[model samples]
Target: MATIKITTESVAALTKSAVPNKTTFYFDNELAGFGLYRTTTGTGTYFAEFRPVAGGSKKRLKLGRVGTLKANEAREAARRAIANAALGKDLAQNRSDERASLTVEELVSKYIEEYVAEHKKASTAGLYRMLLKKHVKPRLGSIKATSLTRVDVQRAHALMTREARVSANRAIKLLSAAYGWGSRHGHVQEGMNPASGIKLNEEEGRERFLTTAEMLAIGNAMIEAETIGLPVDAGTTKHAPKGQLVVMSPYATAAIRLLMLTGARLREILNLRWSEVDLERGVLRLPDSKTGKKTVFLPTAAVDIIKGLTKLGSYMIAGESAGTKHEKPRSDLKRPWAAICKRAGVNGVRIHDLRHTFASTGVGDQMGLPVIGTLLGHADPSTTQRYAHLADEAARRAVEAIGGKIAAAMNGGK
Candidate 1:
């Protein structure tokens, strides 16, 4: 075992290395006796090791697994264990008591309060809560945390899969996380995550992308929507006078343009603030993205789009009627996007498809996958590897072009 300052980045970096033949251990520098052991397969389990008495052998208390509990959370667990040990408390009996009569529902509540609320983003926490309440609680909530078998988990997953295949997978993921947290924190026995090693539902990738012609149509439609406006739906116009048209906000049009120009996620562009935009540096410095802090380099076209847009309040994409005392960013561009797509004669294309269109355009142009990945702010290279086939297609086209020239020369320039 090696002693070092443990951090989230350092622990994550371990996954990049080759797996060991046996379990390896690393301890925290700040908190001695608090460490994590990595199995031969690369999974790590946090633990607190200390002598139960002054002259007695040291005992190791398992805290939680890596990926489920962050390094800080593990450290906190180690601290609590040390404090309890100092008070002459029996750690083993306390752990047994903690696990006694604990149900899946109770574990879910504890996980949300102690772990999810403190560690997860608000959006992610809300999604977790929804998954637990709607799917997991309905099926497996009554089961004892220690007694939840893999078969029970499978049954719940199957039931949810019959209704929403994707959500079923996500709910199982959350349940697994809760069980893992429970085990680590002594609410359940170690290695009792029933949701583990289960196969998730096969989900088809939604990778819709626009062609050049389709992109042109969208651009023209944006212009039209901003100018003449699209016709209001009969259902919506029922509450209004006749002949009222729905005009797309300039901010909405600009937001769409940015989405196409920059291969950013919808929320990244929608929730962007003025302070985050560094026009001189040509980058958007996001403090907190889905993958933590990220800097999005702006291309010339994207920069031009931003330059042309007038800042309405603090946010680049202002909500309805800016300049109010209580201003907020636009929640979504659903209506504007739908209206523009309808006018463009494009059907079944989501706003997110614009991001795909941007990425595909780059891939089609033979930009290197690493370069494209960097522009898209993909932390993992494997994520960029999704476009590997697209890169092969580009290579095939290049070879064909070269062959065509040779054929033309062979045929006397025919």
Candidate 2:
């Protein structure tokens, strides 16, 4: 029995002792209808247990620890536990019951396991995991599901936007979906999605396209640099002879030329497989495209590039290997694209813009909107209508050609 006076000094002195195992501190007084006991069970594990002296039967009430819970703090807790015990209430059991209710972190885990994996695609599941781990979990993981507010969600979204606008919008959408899932199931109360009214800022339209002169300049630069060779890692012994080195696969040069001739999307051309192309039939079959499924008929210039690519390897575009199952058919084009643009003296012309240039050029050459739409694989006609102004300019050229034909006919009759 370790006897300690009911004073604040004695409580502090008793807790600082080097007792390795369980030790109980006993108070001298009856404590005025309150009984406080400090129980130390090994290092760092300390708790204050309280029992009533004046009221009913003995009921143990745990009040935190020794280091965290001070002598004054333990006395305050003992007083409350005495009052609650006198009223026949169990304070410790009530706290345990309250904690048994679901928290936001627990609900998020459940949502991912039950909802996200089953319904959404693999990429979507990956996105949800990233948003929750990076944005939502850190700020609101400990909050109770029923207690979350709209302001909490607003702050989370705002924090994400500080880094990136697109990421912020994606986080807001994921949060909305999670809360909606919580509401549908009984984890959260009805009509209580915190992210319900949040809206993302409008995104700016893509307006970057290269001119024919700019395209020609880029091709000329690639011809001058002639740096096409396997790039060895720095400090390695695999250095190539000076002036003999050339950038890997002139595919950007080939891809740009093909896009200008066929007006196909950059991805469609970059991801093209040898199995998908029919050089004999003069058509290229694109199995997976933005418009679902489509094919492009190659012109003489585009066909010549395809024939030239077959001499390189299995892939039509002999660029960087994407580490896919088939070594030949790659999923992406590497830095040769940027190197080509650097040589061309063109600023900010992305690979995708080559496709835009192709469309604009087709509309400039008197091609019909319907004809250009088919060539571009536009899922909706409205998508192709953005290039209608260019189509109208081409129509004027066609009208002039017809006018010249009519004049020639009249002159021949005279």
Candidate 3:
């Protein structure tokens, strides 16, 4: 060990200093616990050395490499580190603890690996991963989980809300789930969820039903996009990689049509298997659904559409490519649906709204609430209550008919 007063001058000279056979250390005369070391391979780093006040083994905490950290900054860091050591803190252990505290990015990654990969379906997990990469990770990933505050969460959610309210709500919901999972599983501190109590933006559930004209426009646009390419905004101020040509996908077309014809969840449609569809019975027996195993009766129109399609091994709407992860059924509906809507001038409607319209049209026809529930595969009665107004109108008509007959009887009696 060489004793030297560590100054800018001293550190500058030490940059060229390295031992041929072994590692060497230079002790700082002014700072007791501070020093610089150089390896035989010419790797130089600054470190702070201290023994615990409670009488333990000597601990060394690495500050940074030469040229990366200035001598003064390293010395100041070392000073603080040594003071903490004298106060019964283990600098090395503290460092280890800090590293162990997961950042938001790390938390989501771990969540995807541990919980999602094991528990969720591939399609479901893929959506979570997509949100993490595109939304959560980019915005709040670098922030440590323990360091996250309510304000930080609110700000992040607010920013996303400005971009897209529905997307913002979904992202926040997923974020909350992730935070809860992390906390429960010890990825974050117990009983600490910064996302807790952060009020989510009110997302009005859409019940937009496409009118006859709108439907015709949409159908025509789908044809146009499938035949030629649909012109899309491509999400750019400049040029986009995929260009303005959003070539429509046949699978997406089928998916959208099926959604319109049969009121089913998007995932149910995307993950529909050949085994599930009972052509003879004119129904689908989905063993897995948003609620549970459900029997979605196929209308003659929906069944005809299904019959018109070519068989694509195991799935009604199989993905393109013979062998790949995405080679199953369709997994997404963003681009094709966007093209259809944009070209057709049918804006402010989501794929889920197609399901809503199915129920809406059913209600208009005075379909029983229980029957509609069965059709939509709603596990809860409350789920069907959103369309209760249809039942109300039917009840009103029945009452009027009964009252009119009673009035006629009274007039005849008089």
Candidate 4:
């Protein structure tokens, strides 16, 4: 029988000379469940040996090795096990139960119903649902939430990144949040969030802005497409094939121009109705937006586009007037926008990028971010901080001017 002192000093001082054979156990004096177990092969490890407070067979679990764990570290691990045993908790069994029941789809559904629907904004909840349905559900939804690993999260992100990088990150973000939600609600064991430490795909923030030349080209393309019609492709000019011919309605052209002039999102402009346009106030008072009730300060250029629309029905861009097919306002300008992009040689550009260009133009003109944020109707100043790059140039210009003045003053009229 091995003597049982089990202190750092005592365990370190124990000699191999007293070894009998087989294995030996040395229980701790201060910490009840902590002990040292060694085999005849000279292998030794720290362990926690305890019977349940609910009355069952005692279980022994290895904590760590003597040399690698240090006596203090091993004791701390043993203390945690002893604490769990006293509480009648079996960590291993709980993990098994979680693995059997908790799945990615189940956890996401629970998160949306219990947390998102009640707490998050309606628009946010909708976006989360869409992201899960399109990106997450089809990929990792069937996997056990507890069995989820960092590799699995990374793989799912990789699959979507080839199509759209931002979309991939959003899906990853939702999964991460859902896992945390699961942990809090006891749907899964705590600290079992695989999405927590997973490496998300590196997303290059798209800051594409139309140059003056490019803008001129787009302007000419819009005119040609609306009036004379243009080829759907680059090389197919005057003698284009039958399917290669495309044209943008004057109304659709105006909508695309408004996107370039105002920093409002796609839905904000597409779903815009005649009632929302306040020609007298010169502001588009959107009753609801992603950021809640917001107002977009329409520049003269944007105002011209809205005023030019015929107001065929309830919408500014309504086609077919009072027809039932076009009653709910123009839902999309996808085809027109694509034709415009192709004609202008601005291929690979998304309609959303036009919003970025709007902000970029404001920044280049030496506008403050707060003022731009107000123009964009950002609810938070920090939300407008992404445009801080434009502010940096203005700051540099101001500093240079001030430094020049100070140098001239200090030169003593030299």
Best by TM-score: 1
True-structure RMSD for candidate 1: 7.1
Count of backbone clashes, every candidate in sequence: 1, 7, 0, 0
Per-residue lDDT of model 4, residues 16-132, tens digit only:
446648788888878887888877767677888888888978887666666656788788778888898889887446645865787799889789888999998776888899988
Query: What TM-score does model 2 achieve against the real structure?
Result: 0.57
lDDT of the candidates, in the order given: 0.84, 0.67, 0.80, 0.78
Question: What clash pairs does model 2 have?
Answer: 218-344, 226-246, 227-246, 227-247, 228-246, 228-247, 229-246
Off by over 4 Å in 2: 1-149, 177-192, 225-246, 251-253, 310-315, 318-331, 396-414
lDDT per residue, candidate 2, 168-227, as tens digits?
A: 787778777777777544456534688789867567767566786897896676565445
Off by over 4 Å in 3: 1-101, 121-123, 219-251, 322-326, 342-345, 401-414
**TM-score of candidate 3 versus the correct structure, residues matched by position:** 0.65
Candidate 1: minimum summed lDDT over ten consecutive residues — where? 234-243
- Residue pairs in collision within model 3: none
The segments of candidate 4 whose C-alpha lies over 4 angstroms from its true place after superposition are 1-102, 232-244, 319-331, 392-414
- Give a tens-digit lDDT track for model 1, residues 1-414: 788788888888876678879999999889878998889888888888877654477778888888878888988888988777777665866788778778898898889879899988876887888888899888999888888899988988999999899999999888898887777667888777899988899999888889878889989988877887767762122344555776667888999999888899888998898999999989999988888899988889989989988877888888865668888668888877877887788888998888778778898888989988888889899998877888899989988999999999999999
Summarize candidate 3's per-residue lDDT along 179-219 as a digit string, tens digits. 77775444565456788788888766667778878889989
- Give the TM-scores of the predictions, in the order they appear: 0.72, 0.57, 0.65, 0.65
Cα RMSD, each candidate: 7.1, 19.1, 17.0, 11.5
